[model samples]
Target chain A: MSSLAVGCRLRVAVLVLALLGAGAVGGGSTAHAADDGELTLDSIVNNVIVGHAEDGNYLNFDPFATVELPRIMVARTADGALTVDLYGSTKGLLKDGTYGLVPHSEGEGGHEEVITESSALQEAFASKAHLHGDIVRTSGHVVADLSITRHLIFGLLAMGIVLAIFLVLAQRYKRGVGRTEAPHGVLQNMMEVMVVFIRDEVAKPNIQGEKWRTFLPYLLSAFFFILMANILGLVPYAGAATSNIAVTGVLAVMTFVIGLLYGSKDHYKHMFLGPPDAPWPIRVILVPIELIGTVMRHLALAIRLFANMMGGSLIIFSLIGLVFIMNVLFGEAMAFGTSIISIGFTVFILLLKLLVAFIQAYVFTILSALFIGISVEEHEHEEHADDAHAEAPTSQTSGALSDRLDAVDDAVDDVTEPAPA
Target chain B: MTEVIAQSLVQPDVGLIFWKTIAFLIFLFLLYRYGWGPITEAMESREEEIESSIQRAEEALAEAKEIQSENKKARREAEREAQRILREARESAEELREEEMAKTRDRIQQMQEQAQAEIEREKQAALQELRDEVADLAIEAASKVVRDDLDGERQRKLVNDFIDDLPKN
Candidate 1:
């Protein structure tokens, strides 16, 4: 018990130190709200929260170091032909002079792109003036702005890492490492444990037997992909791709589409016809409610993951931003004192954020599998019952909880493999 | 659109969604084909192999037990057969010994009876002879008393003729 407490304290101290260091590095160049001398609420909102979470062109490591990625877009040219424009970076696109940035005349969403005459596009950005809005080559008619942004790169990195890891693992198994022989070393063992856990624990109980195998690939992909993205978000400069609603929304949509595609005949019946014994008057109200509920649940599945991930970064930033707010309110001495509390809360939130990272990934995956599970579920009726009697109706994700017992039995008999009881 | 990037964090931007869709689909496809599919297949096959191996082991154990029991039964039968053969042989030997002793006793009794009959015949012959000899001696003594008068030859001849007619004894 004492050791556990010490371990917790040690983690908190490490988190506090790491966040303080990050804050110190990020303090000087928040960019947007530096208009005023002090760190204001506007700075916290514009620079700290938005800047960390936004899908921008430049990969902002710190204010000092930023890497600009390529911009790609498709636009309808004035000649009435579709053209794809590519740039080395946003700077290259502006330098090309075919496109220029104008604050959206609509006044809200930042910048819009319009054609320029010369190779030296918008003369203002020709040199450099806060030109961070993704400007693609367009005649004020950008059909598709597929610009490679910071979040995309990090998202790809997370995905690439997943691919790299799994490819190697797959190859190892292909060579009969985990297949014929015992999975050796930490990497293989750890991953096999994770894969098996996802299969038995996440996929099995939530989705019934045999059916789980059909969706196993999708479920495993979502689980590990989200997990990888979430973990990447915890890294100091790397942000979570799942924090973006667009990304999570796309993921959720994938689930929605899969459920729609593979949903059973019974599932459609349940969706269209709400309940068996309802009066038509009540059924009229309930049917819409049920439909909306199904749609909302999936949508919430997306938003929940986005919100949890985004909320963590937001809270962490806000917690640390309080230090500066306190500095201006009181004095330098009070600011130093506030730093202690700021660091404390930031440490706690950071740890919670770490936990939430894994949790949100799990929640998103399980919820997705559940939605698909239900959509494909054969409704057990008095007439046509489900044949899967081995797995119970309301079984929870506790099947893998007995792996230790199976492992013990496995030792007693090598042939009796470690399948959960 | 001053905060275009800013709003993208919350709003589902069409451009970002397009890219996200492309990226996620590719990621999902690649992962399923290379990683998820093969991994699950390998694990499932391994589990099946293990299950079959366990079944075979159980079958083998049961067969061995059956063979062991069968061997024990066969051994017991062989022992019983040997004991039966030994007892029969002993019983036959005792009967043969009893029969041989009875046959030997009957033979001995028959031989004794034959010998006794022969002995009686010999005794009768001897008595006849004695009688003849006595009669011949008296005749001889009377003849001697009458001064050898006796027709000795005639007396012998008559005794011989009388013996031949009386008994082919």
Candidate 2:
């Protein structure tokens, strides 16, 4: 208990230190805010540029502040060519109520504003920018750059490399390469156990016979891919690709497709048209329910992965925001107190994020397996009914009894039948 | 027209880029190919090896137990055989001692009987010799008395009595 309290205290202390450090860095730069006529966080977010008439009116080049996002320049479509206009307050805006162009317009004076704010500008900004002819206009802060995107790609690539290395080592261990017997390395041993566990505990139970192996590759692939992606996202500056709805949606769709392709007729017929085992009245209500359920299950898969990753990031962001808010309201001392709490929460969330990553991956893989299993499941009652029809003409009328008998027969058939060609 | 054209531009839908799909496909393929297969297989084989090793150890233990039991039985059997041999030897020695004691008793009984017979024979001979000597003395004394007086009559009387007594014996 004492240890826990101490840990909590330490976390709070760290948060406070981080908050103070940020405040110090920011404060030192803005020490002369009165003289500079800039002090607020909003001004920093907007950025500013200064110029002096002294020294032959030379430009004072200093960015007031840089935002986390980049400025987005959207081009408009028109016959003359595309042109982008900057709006709102930014570093490019001059003190004389004008905007600066990136490249001076053909000697239109240095630091000249290409587009000025006016009544027409307000109207233009209200409507979604149009793309017509050769000109189209749209602009926003470009939060990501090529480097950021590359970093994300690199994160994914690094995970792939790690997985590849593990595979190579595992394969070598399996083949007994470079050793007289199975390698005793920790990695080799761990891999061996996981392989066996997945085969027996996961694949064997949920998947049937020779067919199980056929689907094993996809299931395993999904598991590791999602798992690695989730873990990578937890790293600082690494974007959670899986957190993106589109990414999770694509994976869910893939699972759905596999379920469709590999699933036996019984899956669709039983789920959609009602299983033979169900009573007529029950089937009437259940078939639709089951069909809807199938859709919901896959949908849930998408939401689960997306929500888990996205939720973790949002929580961390909120915690960080809390520190800044505290600093603004209660000054440095109270900010430190709050910073500790926030940072501790952030750390806790980070740990949980790690666990959630693995769990979500497992859940996705297992659910996918379940779907595949369900799809291919043979309705014993149906098979038994068929057999009863063949063996005894009156056997189908017994309803419940016949259903049970048919189920037995179907199960037997499932076991006896060879893999379909 | 140029001023109007310069005023507007459209943002590119980078989010909707087809490159995402391409990247996703590449990632999935690479991950499938290199990552999951061997790890799973390795884990499985490791478990199999451990299970088999345990089974082998158990079998060896059972075999060892069997050998030990067999050894114990053999040792017991050998001990029992040795005891049986000792018992037989002891019984034989006892029988030999009994036989020797019985022979010694018989010999002593025979010697005692022979000695009694010898003593009885000697006593009978002595008695017979004494009676003969006494009879001779009495006859001589009777002859002297008859010569002095009616010695013939006395000697005749004594001889007659002796003859009667001899006839009775």
Evaluated with lDDT, which candidate comes out highest?
1
DockQ, per-model, please? 0.24, 0.07
CA lDDT, candidate 1, residue B60 = 100
| Candidate 1 ranges beyond 4 A from true positions | A1-39, A78-81, A102-139, A380-421, B1-6, B55-169
Q: What is the C-alpha lDDT profile of model 2 across A209-265, one tens digit per residue?
A: 567777777776667667777787676545466665556777787888888888876
lDDT of 2 at A85: 44
lDDT at A5, model 1: 30
lDDT (Cα, tens digit) per residue for candidate 2, span B74-146 = 9999999999999999999999999999999898888888888888887777666756665666667667656
RMSD of 1: 11.8
Scoring only the A-chain of each prediction against the true A-chain gives TM-scores of 0.75, 0.57
Q: In terms of DockQ, which candidate is strongest? A: 1
> Any runs in candidate 2 off by more than 4 Å, and if so which?
A1-155, A175-186, A189-201, A277-291, A326-337, A381-421, B1-36, B107-169
Model 1 quality (TM-score): 0.66
Looking at candidate 1 chain A, the ten consecutive residues that score lowest on lDDT are A412-421
Instruction: State residue B80's C-alpha deviation in candidate 1, in Å.
Output: 14
- Candidate 2, position B61, lDDT: 100
